[model samples]
Target: MAAAIAARLFPGRIYVASAGVRRGSADPFAVAVMEEKGLDIRAHRPHTFEDLEDMNFDLVITLAPEAHHRALELTRYYAVDVEYWPTADPSATAGSREQILASYRNVRDGLEKRIKERLGWTPPVSA
Candidate 1:
């Protein structure tokens, strides 16, 4: 959802990417929930921090607390802004499919709202 909002708000102005502390496949439940907001996650495959070492970014935002620790540890060697966003772990929620999907939607909506509140605005014109 963050990626989707960033994609919409910034378009070609910013490069937005997401990776996990550990490598894994993209969660289907996540894809479903994101689709509710018209964001497609079908092609988004999960990656590890190691896959992200070559590039530089202005800010590194971590959604999960565990990811916050890992990002801080990583950025200590480099210089970048690390912002921790405490978000719920939808995967940890227990219930039926609809219940689980509701959890995902809540997380997705929260992320979308936060992203908009944080960065949704007109970009400054470049000289």
Candidate 2:
């Protein structure tokens, strides 16, 4: 969700890679929420930190403690910045269909805001 938002908000401005300590398929709820934002993340594959060793990253914003720790470990060998945003794991939220989707939507919206603010991006005026 964060990666997709950042990419859309700041296309050529920076290179963005999304990696975790563990790899898993993109969350369906996350994909659905992003689609509501007009961004298709169905093809976004989850990757681990090791999966991107050959790639260089300027900054890594981790939403979970485990990721932050792993990214800090990455800093031991690579010159990169990591920031922890302490985001809520929407998947952990328990509720009905609409209520559950609300959780995903909240995460999606929060990530969009943070990505815009942290990366200093403002949408171009639509003419």
CA lDDT of every candidate: 0.81, 0.87
Which residue pairs clash within candidate 1?
A: none
lDDT tens readout by residue for model 2, 1-127: 8988888888888888888888889888988888998999999889898998564777889999999998898776878777999999999989797888999999889988888888888769998
TM-scores of the candidates are 0.86, 0.93
The C-alpha stretches of model 2 lying farther than 4 A from their native spots are: 53-55
lDDT of 1 at 89: 89
Highest lDDT model number:
2
RMSD of each: 3.7, 1.3
**What would the per-residue lDDT of candidate 1 be over residues 4-78, giving only the tens digit for each residue?**
768877889788888668888879999998877787888887787778756477788889888888878777877
